[model samples]
Target: MADPVAAVAALDEPNRRKLYDLVARATCPISKDEAAAAVDLPRTTAAFHLDKLVEMGLLTVVHERRTGRSGPGAGRPAKLYRRSDEQIAVSLPDRRYEAASHLVTDALVEAEQTGEPARVILNRRAYEWGADLAGQAAEADASRGPASNRVTEALARFGFEPLAEGGSILLRNCPFHSLAHRHTELVCGMNLCLISGLLDGIEASGVTAHLDPSPGHCCVRISQAPSSRSPSVSR
Candidate 1:
């Protein structure tokens, strides 16, 4: 996978960014000479920046003969540049809306084929995915300390930004922020199921996941189970 941060940083230079835009907008790959002329830069300068973009995985290079000739007389193939197929995204707080979108799409398709409710399918799939993630983490490292710590580590790995506060785990960032805002009930319910599955897969005890929405935070919160909560005694 291409590092999105590096890809974005590669465009920070003015000439490089311009060259990238020019090549991306073109219908076909562009040669170094064409790119230099279009950007009003020297050929060497343009080539340097273009190659840098290629190094950063923002652009891909191809060598093809501009002149339609197959014999030895045909000069060395021209170095052509074009936008890469790699998808680069950088989101603050590390949202995973793309994953959520895929899950929803799969749920809709499965519901149509199996004649099941979309909501039910989505929740079940999300739960299974969460459990799979936990299982993978456990397999990666068996000795991950206590259940709470393991759960927090898994949540953080998935970009939930879990924060341990008092006896509850408050998710500081929602991996599906925009979608949750638009489809509050559906997305939140899916998220709850996912976390619940993670907890179950890891065999977490005395902790229950629930919907506890607040401004600027995930809709779901993990807190002490009702039976595990201790009553306050009068002094």
Candidate 2:
């Protein structure tokens, strides 16, 4: 699991946080001396804090020759630092507003082009996005030893706090709680479809997703597949 807390905590120190902001604001990777001059700190002080940020994964370090020469007189290569490409999200209970935004954005684009209803497009796009996530998860799992119970890990990774309950997995948190509260029918229906697609993408045959709505819980629940059921999601 990505630790948002660690990333956030790393920025608590005032000078370290200032150095991070300076590097992040730069259009390109910056040298420690340049960073020190901007922030009015000694080069050694700047290097110390900048290295700490790199250690925390907030910044990435690379070595490059500042001068356009490669001879002995060109001097030593300078170390450059820049903001890491990794994204940092710090939701207290872990919300997935980005996921909601992606589905809605895709829906709008497809609806505009295909002349389909926005809601319909939203559902289809959401399912596709979920499947893409599952596909990526599968690839990652393949590289890290044999596959185990990835369903629960996948759910948790996507911010749907899954709780194992006998043969079923109950979702404790809905990443789209605020949106779902306002538009329960639409959001819940979309959730069901997305999870269904995820299950199919992961190729888990014995388990299935169902629409088991309860207050303060996700609308979808995963359980052992029934002998017979409709191809579509149930309410």
Candidate 3:
């Protein structure tokens, strides 16, 4: 998937954004001339912006002969632009609602098949998924570091935004913020289990995952395990 930030930034230019809106609102693919006329831009300038949008994955391109005649007198196929099927979303602090939705959907399907509680399946699957994320991070970079630093680095990439204060790693952002607001108990429980599984998979025995909820932050926090009391900090 393309970076959401870059994809969104591509539309920051006025002419590019206007051409995008024009093409997106059209029922069928539109040629550069049609888009330029609709948006009151020169055909060449509109074509440049349209192609840039295509490169950014905001639009897709196809060539088609607009004229009915094809064999003898038909001109070359006109390049048409349309909105791509890619879903682009940018959230402050980087929320992962889509990931939460997929987990919930999977749990529902499995629960229906096995006659197990959806919540149970959700918590288990979330933990497994979290562990998988940590495992992938470990595989990507094999350097050894403090447990807290490893946890912070792993969670940061997943949009948890972990911040170290004194001896504990406080998560400043919850990836499933919106879902957690509507279903606090269920989502928070799943979050706790997920972080716990991450700690387990990463072999971060020096730290423990806790359900310490506060406003504007993730419910999961990592603290130094009592037996391994050592001051480790990271941002």
Report, for every candidate in turn, its global Cα lDDT versus the true structure. 0.86, 0.82, 0.83
| Residue pairs of candidate 2 with colliding backbone atoms | none
lDDT, candidate 2, at 79: 91
Question: For residues 141-230, could you state the per-residue lDDT of candidate 2 as single tens digits?
Answer: 775332227888778878889998998999999988898889988888888878877777776667888889887789889888754232
Q: What are the per-residue Cα lDDT tens digits for candidate 3 across 36-122?
A: 898898988998999889988999999889886797779898889999999999998788888888988999999899998888888
Please say which candidate is ahead in TM-score: 1 or 3: 3
Superposed model 1: Cα runs more than 4 Å off: 70-77, 132-150, 197-208, 223-235
Model 3, position 7, has a per-residue lDDT of 85
- Which regions in candidate 2 have their CA more than 4 angstroms from the true location? 25-29, 37-42, 62-77, 84-86, 143-148, 227-235
The numbered model that scores best in TM-score is: 2
Ranking by lDDT: 1, 3, 2
What is candidate 1's CA lDDT for residue 86?
A: 89
Q: What is the TM-score of each candidate against the true structure?
A: 0.76, 0.80, 0.78
**Candidate 2 — worst ten consecutive residues by lDDT sum?**
226-235
